[model samples]
Target chain A: MSDRGHLKKTAHLAEVPAALEAGPRGAKPRRLVSTRTIVVYGTLFVAAAYYLLPLYVMIVTSLKGMPEIRVGNIFSPPLEITFEPWVKAWSSACTGLNCDGLSRGFWNSVMITVPSTIISIAVASINGYALSNWRFKGADIFFTILIVGAFIPYQVMLYPLVIVLREIGLYGSLAGLVIVHTIFGMPILTLLFRNYFASLPEELFKAARVDGAGFWGIFLKIMVPMSLPIFVVAMILQVTGIWNDFLFGVVFTRPEYYPMTVQLNNIVNSVQGVKEYNVNMAATILTGAFPLLVYFVSGRLFVRGIAAGAVKG
Target chain B: MTGQVTGRATVRAHPGRPSRLTRNLSAKIASIPMMLTAVVVFLGGTLWTVLYSFTSSKLLPRLKFVGLDQYERLWAAPRWLVSIENLAIYGVFSLIFSMVIGFMLAALMDQKIRFENTFRTIFLYPFALSFIVTGLVWQWLLNPEHGIQSVVRAMGWTGFDFNPLYDSSIVIYGILIAALWQGTGLVMCLMLAGLRGIDEDIWKASRVDGIPMWKTYLFVVIPMMRPVFVTTLVIIASGIVRVYDLVVAQTSGGPGIASEVPAKYVYDYMFQAQNLGQGFAASTMMLITVAIIIVPWAYLEFSGGRKRV
Candidate 1:
């Protein structure tokens, strides 16, 4: 009886923080169904159908053979499901000179995305850590500028960045594109990490500091372990963001290094093709697969990341 | 022996110590990249582009001063005017529709429905897709021969005309539909977050006062969610101005450039036509448009907050 009582006390103690975290909107009142319930469910169902329609069409169209697509209804389930389109999309789909398929672009995206995500997150995380923990004169001003700069459209900075890349002899290369991604991604990732680090327990930081840990030492040992969730959130934001990016990829890289989105666009919308609708839909699905996978796997984190971005902005 | 000598040297140097600028040397070093991006890329680049807009350079940027000549030519171009008109139409419709639809969906989600996560997941998955993917999927879906038009015709409507991609007058609306589909989910998420941020007590109080749910959402809830609405508005507005990739994939600004946007105009002129001056001018105009939107909002947000504080 005493052990159970002690366990209950500790559990209640833990829940206090969770309850405070939920603020005044903690509990949702239970209620019975009424007209309002029906109305809400009906509206949500319709909206869900609207949102899911495209994905459904894409899948069904991708599965059907060409003749089936040409004759039958798009809303219908595939009469004859085929994997040939997926195989073709992954291997033999043409985008101008290249018929090696989206594989090349996929590889290019991986090459670009991996390094870019890492570098951007590393730089932004450290910068965020510094800004949040180590306040110096003129830091806030620069932080403000960085935040405001995010609102500036890419067109304003495109040519200038091109010039900078050219001067550094990295223009038209994957390296240049990686640098571009880092620069553009700095604002959001920094904001994310900054807010996260700021929210961490100051006592922990002080405890580590008083134990003779320096800046890098404290960060590497204490802060990094404590903030793994934030790191995951940052990774999700960057992976999906840099993967889905079209502007920077188109701007900073040459044709050989074009990312998946670019190649998909070219293949699907190339003016001189016979317009293979199945292959195009398959290609579209393929291009979206990575981010969609991330979204599905880390669903709530995706929401939290975007919500943090939106709220803070 | 070397460590002892170094320690003695450091102890001797500590009498004077370092300047304030060098106090947090590691932090200052870590922040260089962000500082350079903010100052050089954003501020310096903006100023450079704006300055170059007044020149008459072509093929490559030059310093030949031409005092608003490029802007004059930009205004004279019928394509730019059409782009502006299309943007206006797309912007207004998208802003209205996304907000209304997004808010309605959020309000619905706030009703404590079952399968809330499933519904939200379905709605927001598209937002994960790139604009290119969104554009291509919609393009195929809206294709007259194989898409909704054919399906509707086969449904015995026989005379249904639903091809917006081909019609210049309503082409932008087609893109608007795709934009709303791709974007409203994010807006809904933002709105839902805002809705959740509201205190549950407010709802109870409104219930006690005998207010309808819709009325509570409107007269009570929305007014309280001003910040969220403003943030959503800014996000949607900024996204509207950069509606390039969708147009590129969907229509390629084609059917005689009916759906061309400012960003596309800048890219084509700069890279394809080799007219740097015109591209710079058009880009400057884009910056001005953003400033026009942002300046007043920033004033209201920052200045108003100061008074409250």
Candidate 2:
């Protein structure tokens, strides 16, 4: 109905959407199944399948027994789905010296991720609050360097970090990996928090400052209390990112302390006797399960997190 | 959206801008972590590695300089050459396919369709998984014995042969496939946000002007979304450079090192072979590659002022 002006006056009115021709207020009613609708939905359906295929295949393959996997093609639905592979992968599948399977790595990941996420987010939020409200003389320079330095390939810094860790007596320990994650996680989280804190009502910060609140006073009492959504977003990003990491896990921690991703890689690729495809798929899913759970459960928040995190150009 | 961030990035020299470092002591202390990370870890670590690349360091970093020797040896190695080639192939195709397919999916989703959230969730779920998991899943899917090859053959196409992971010539493409599957969802999400950010008035105006949707998209919409596209380009470019664990879990750089990447080269050289100089050189090259792409973009983004935003 808003397009009525264009329809009455414009020479190219015929080119407007057919819905405008229905001349009704609100939505236009059309055939439920048209050629264009079919094509659009059809392409999306095919794409959704392509995207979902691996997860489907992984689940299907993991459910079948090894004997069945040997005989059946990968795509076929299991004749008899079994939870044996899931149990085996979680408990018994070997990664070299460790026959405790993925549980050890999973716990290791939890240990690394919790501390890393908390420390990184805490540091970044304070940095963000400082930059936004308590702007120091040379603070912007360091923040700028941090953002730009994020693009530098981690390979260049990996060795130097090893040296630093060795000097600090944290090398090959889980603590070292936590520090690595915190350092790497800083740039994005800082930027995320910086923009977020800046967007808050300026009156809020000024009001606190006028009330004679100091730096930590305003931050802990005023800023942190008001930014729960942002904290959740940062946590989502760090937990998933730190959990999915392999290079830092492989480099910073000894084999006995490998994270789930690294250990999953080892168990699957180690050329063990009687290559068990079912167990392999189950272990793979187990490794990916946490982040996937977060992604699904958080839904829109996960999108917001990545959008904020990845759009750091 | 980024306009708002860029606008807020530079807090002006009024109200909040604290005078001198002595003031806001707790703020400075709180910022010590950011400073140490930016200085010690990022800047110092990068410089330290670059300096050490000149030395013939092995098993440990030593300061004995042998200028250009490590770089020379790195370029001469056949494996290094192959890694570079694989990166180029992986980079070019990954960029093109990711942009096009991601945009296409986003455009379709922008058509005001049903189940948009369902479709988006399905597409993005793979991105949540680690590269290690993606690699292992694809390795199983591409296995010649019981994966895609046998499945296709079982459908009466006995001549079917689609084993990219096993064949040296196409093995990188195999990795490329998994990479795209895990990645393009993020790109689509970004592009969809960009599409949504485009004022609806433009679409209405284009319709009134009798412009075809494709023409409007190519000439008007894409050009308008320059910042988003550039940001995506940088993200994908940086990611392509660091594709290590995927190759490791999928093929372990084998089918005879056919799928080696620079990141993997650095890891193996430094850690496994204990050849620190070689790893240093390879990693320096990686840094330079990123700089070549990033520096100019950062310059354009910053120097152009907040006018674009």
For candidate 2, write residues B157-253 as lDDT tens digits: 9999899998999999999999999999999999999999998779778866657789999999999999889989989998898889899999999
DockQ of 1: 0.48
lDDT of 1 at A240: 90
Q: Residue A252's C-alpha lDDT in candidate 2?
A: 93
Report the C-alpha lDDT of model 1 over B1-309, residue by residue, as the tens digit. Answer: 122222224455675764565566677777899889889998899899999999999988999999989999999999999999998999999999999999988888876677889999998998888899999999988999888999999989999999999999899999999999999999999999999999766876665555667899889999999999998999888888888899999999978989999999999988789899999999999888888888888998999868988
Using lDDT, give the best candidate's number: 2
lDDT for A141 in candidate 2 is 93
lDDT digits (tens) for residues A137-220 of candidate 2: 899999988998889889999998998999999999988898999999999999999999999999988787677666777788
True contacts kept of each: 0.68, 0.82
Give the true-structure RMSD of model 1: 6.3
